[model samples]
Target: MTRILVVGATGLVGREIVRKALRDDRITRLIAPTRRPLEPHPKLHNPLVDFDRLPEDAGWWAVNSVICVLGTTRAKAGSDQAFRKVDYDYPLAVARLAHRHGAMRFALNSSLGAAAAPRLLYSRTKGEIEAAITAVGFSSLTIVRPGLIGGDRNEFRAGEWIAARVLGALGPLLPRRFRISPAPKIADALVEAAIAGASGVHLIEADQLAAD
Candidate 1:
């Protein structure tokens, strides 16, 4: 039986990941942690967590794999430091805990152009987190770099909504790397990667994510 842990369960990508994982027969259990609590499900368990101060309980980390979809925009986070805390610190912390608790695989939802030397703070933060998690020595690491994700979001971000609508209209005319991929497609890819049991880091680009 495969038990999985999903962080950022309330977000757009995270929510779909949980939904898909719950339906997968391979996943015997799904542990979802969020800042705000989520409703109960037969195969899913929700844990309320404080990002700044995660609980000491080791139970949640004792899963087969850990998928991190935790992220926030600069506008929503209010500052670069705040955004880094969510995009970098919190996810890295979860990765460390998951590794220590015996998780073999770690999958993350990163962004396109993530690099440690980038001028963009968001991309740099994500790169740093990826490096940090890699250092933890997980047996398998899957880093998914999805471009402008298209889906109904929990929070109203006018920028994202406009971008999605615009890209939706443009369709195949847009660049493959810049195209808007569906949330459910990305979620499906994550589950497939986990189930495949492929070892080592796999960098899934926007085109590959959209193809999935």
Candidate 2:
């Protein structure tokens, strides 16, 4: 049985992944360290933690695999530095801790434009995080890069809300690569890849993730 650690368990896609991971028979234990609490589950071990001050020596980091769905918008973060801290710093912190504790598989919910290139700050941040995570040396690295995510978010983002609606309406008429990706679809792909823990790096793009 595999023991897994999931970061960002409270978010939209993260919640879906957590639910599936908790129910997976292959997963013996699921550790989700969040600021708030997740509902009780027999297989889950929830630890309330501060991202800025994670417990360095916690025994819970000893997992076989890790799934990171941790991210934030620039608007919500209030600044570029704050966004980078959440998107880049936080994920890398979790990856290093998990790697140190013997986790071999690391799966991340990245964005479509993630690449080491001179692009938008958001895209560049994602690229840097991917690069940083690779440096951590996980045997099995999986990055699922979804486009505009379609789901019911707790809070509203004017731009994203409008995009999701437009792309959703376009549906099959829209190109697969640029279509609105359902949150659950991305979650499913991330969970499966993390649990599988296949060797080498696997980059799943939005078009592939959109597949049923």
Per-residue CA lDDT of model 2 for 43-78, tens digit only, reads: 999999999999999999999999999999998999
Query: 1-212, model 1: which lDDT tens digit per residue?
Result: 79998998888888889889988999999988887878788898887778788775658779899888998899988999999999999999898888888999988888888894588898889789888988989888988889898888767888888888888788888778888878888888777776665888888899986633
Worst 10 residues of 2 by lDDT: 112-121
Give the C-alpha miss distance for residue 183 in model 1, angstroms.
0.3
Candidate 2 residue 113 Cα shift, in angstroms, is 0.9
Q: In model 1, where is the ten-residue run with the lowest total lDDT?
A: 188-197
User: How many residue pairs clash in model 2?
Assistant: 0
Each prediction's Cα lDDT score?
A: 0.85, 0.90
- Residue pairs with colliding backbones in model 2 are none
Clashes of each: 0, 0
RMSD of each: 1.6, 1.2
